[model samples]
Target: MKNYKFIYVLIGLTFFLSSCEEWLQVEPRQSIDSATALSSQEAITAATNGVYARFRSVALYGRDFLAIPELLADNAFNTGAGNRLVGQFNNQPGSHMGNWGTAYFTINQINLILRALQEVELPVEFRNRIRGEVLFLRALLYHDLARVYAYDPTADIPGVNVGGVPIVTQGTLTVAEVEYPARNTVDEVYTFIYNDLEESLGLMQNFNMNRRPFFVTRGAVAALFSRVALYRGDYARAIEMSEIAMASGVANFPADPVSGWRTQVQPESFFEIVFTTQDNIGANESLRATFMSRVFLNDAVAASHGNVVFTDELAAAFPDEDLRRDLIQRGLAVNSGVFEINKFASKNGVPNLDNVPVIRYSEAITNKAEAHYHLGQFDLALTELNKLRVRAGLEALEGITGPQILDEILLEKRREFAFEGHRFFDLKRLGRDIIKPTGNVEHSDFRILANIPNREIETNPSLVQNRGY
Candidate 1:
């Protein structure tokens, strides 16, 4: 999270001198409103930058998002060999806090940008696009938040009206006034997310950009809508939105293998946050060296610590002829035994400058497959899943029924998008409970949703604590 502390400090000072309004007005620094402060193109761009800035924050795209969720969930396990503080999140307080901190920080940034966008004057089209993008981003953040914090509304607690985290839409507030708001129902939050993305798809349809996948486009909004709908169990809507997104041709997979596979922001990427070597903000120092290296070799820190090897379960899941195993994993012999690491790592000695693909064509394909399966289009689901399999040089699946096909699709998703932050959410939405190595089991309860930060709670009494906090 970028420092909202500075903003908080400014707000504090403004209140401190409330009695001396006349004197404060005489000072040039004290007169600007939040809107007036960010009215120009430069300022608006800076505000947009704030949104992008969160992508690298430890809470979002940073290692925490990738590591914590997996470790806490069943997708992966932390070795608990190094960094005990991080490894501790396999349980309750630690798990909740880690997720809560990350989500709220991202939400706070979006709220700030949304507030700033309200005051800026730009071309109507551009302004509308930007507003739509902000709404989409905020909705995306909330969607993730809802998934992590609350139980699935469609499953364990069927139709249960559980509350999610506080909904913060504005950035204008004193520290005292801005702590937390009451939890909104999961239904309410999902509704807000769906409505935001629905509007965003319409508003961003014609947004033009020099870089195809660097900014939010109509396709990104549509893809997000599909994802959001899938989470809500609206399979029909999910299939429809994903089909529309794919039909746009914005997410067509390219034929250029090296450039296409290695590039962070591909033409097929609906939306992605670009992370250059110069601006990398993730906390995992060895992440670049681990994932970017061509060979399945780990850095000394990772290799010595034994933190980056494939589990036996995952290795056994792939068939011998699956080409994705060759494309993504590397076999290494250690102590006369073999192990694997996902191949998406940067090639040998190459600095991993590849921008992270936040949303891509493959996701659309998988979304379509899942939706189709849910809609009882078993053969059609298999067709879509096989399209990705063939692209990865694997043989097509055969003789699978609708429900059986869902398992195959999820397994393929685990293999295809491993270590890319999709696994935990996939498992959760599918109603798979996480059984932790610590012997703690997380069943479907709204407890999975994280509580608002204690700092926020102290400042704002209105903020409701998440269940089980």
Candidate 2:
């Protein structure tokens, strides 16, 4: 923890870290000024803000992880030329699958804060709240890494010994500690992630943790556990956790569902990573730069910079009556003919400064619906799904009960989360083939799993690359 630690102090959300240049390098410990930073409740809070800053970078939720998954799946269409994110899929996996660096950097910051909180003499509530939030963030990052970089534990062909990302609990202080660490098995990493989240739940009870979407509250922790359980195929646990989360008031839809997408912090959001003008990833190269073009909507200041566009399939499949369809815009791409996708458009009239939702009420409901369908509670599953349908301004279906209901729930999930980065992982969890029109992908295709970044494999010879990369 000392090695990755820095004097990260926040003055009104602007973090000033000491020795920032070597934050991500492989070297021995330089004694961190842990005393100064962990000395008070306020300083520790500042350190936690630094972790949020790490999350807001381009590599994590700020851009690549949030936007690229849709491109990898059928949610977005390639613009035929000069769309580099589209170009990434055509490029080799070894180079394009590059989420390792930013993810670990965020994880490292969380670990440092966790370690610092251990000895700090803060009030009990503050200490526990800080600890719980850091633990939740840590689990969240590891979950994404395992899902994207490793084979799912439930993958049919996998044995118990399949590789996952390295399980780094505490931050490393020396080159020898993590420079050559081998990958953990998929089960081991998942176990590690669950342990952190479970512990976080205990520490977070009734503590709203700022009572806002930016921090993961006790209810959000429950929602996250429900999500993890559903994805991990623990259907019974997911159902139970989803009930707890809903009873905790975490699954209630926003009062204004249509405006929720463009609201800075949607009311339905359980946990979000916020961006401000001070820390905004700018217009030229952030999410707005890659997804939408700003124009013609009577808002020129927040015009879109187009990259990926909605597929004709997505546009047609998303029912016109659904308010979500309004989020999609009909516009021309710089590279292709007229197309549409406004899911990532600016919310506050500034390009690329929109907040990113990590977990939301609709997802909690999605988890509940899926879990119920898996457990043969077909009526309950349909009821949960109908809530989302009605919220989207669609009429609820009647008498659709039985195993076939899973398809309904899945389709609802796709329509609800179209560009919010759920498509690829959802297909993986279902063990289904990805079928895009004029698409060559099939079931059991090795490329569905991306390869380890070549640079990572080069640095650590012990790491195993994914199949057929």
Q: Which candidate is the best by lDDT?
A: 2
Off by over 4 Å in 2: 1-35, 80-82, 89-92, 95-97, 159-161, 176-179, 295-297, 300-304, 332-337
My TM-score estimates for the predictions, one after another, are: 0.81, 0.87
What is candidate 1's lDDT per residue for 1-469, written digit by digit as tens?
A: 2146547645543532232222123232334344344555544554555566566655666445555555455545444334432433455563542556555655665665566566666778767877787888888788877877676656546554456656777664455544445877778888888888888888887773443776777888888898888888999998999988888766777653234554444666887766655555422443443232223234432332224334456667667766556544443333124343443454323444345667778888899999899889998999999987887667788897957898889888877776566866776677776664555555555545555566665655566666556
What is candidate 2's lDDT per residue for 338-405, written digit by digit as tens?
45666566676775678888887888888999888888888889999999989888999788888678
Per-residue error (Å), model 2, residue 406: 1.3
- How good is model 1 by TM-score? 0.81
Clashing pairs in 2: 292-305, 293-304, 293-305, 294-303, 294-304
Report the number of clashing residue pairs per model. Answer: 14, 5
Alpha-carbon RMSD to native, per candidate: 6.3, 5.5
At residue 52, candidate 1 shows an lDDT of 63
lDDT value for model 1:
0.62
Q: Mark the 10 consecutive residues where model 2 has the least summed lDDT.
A: 5-14
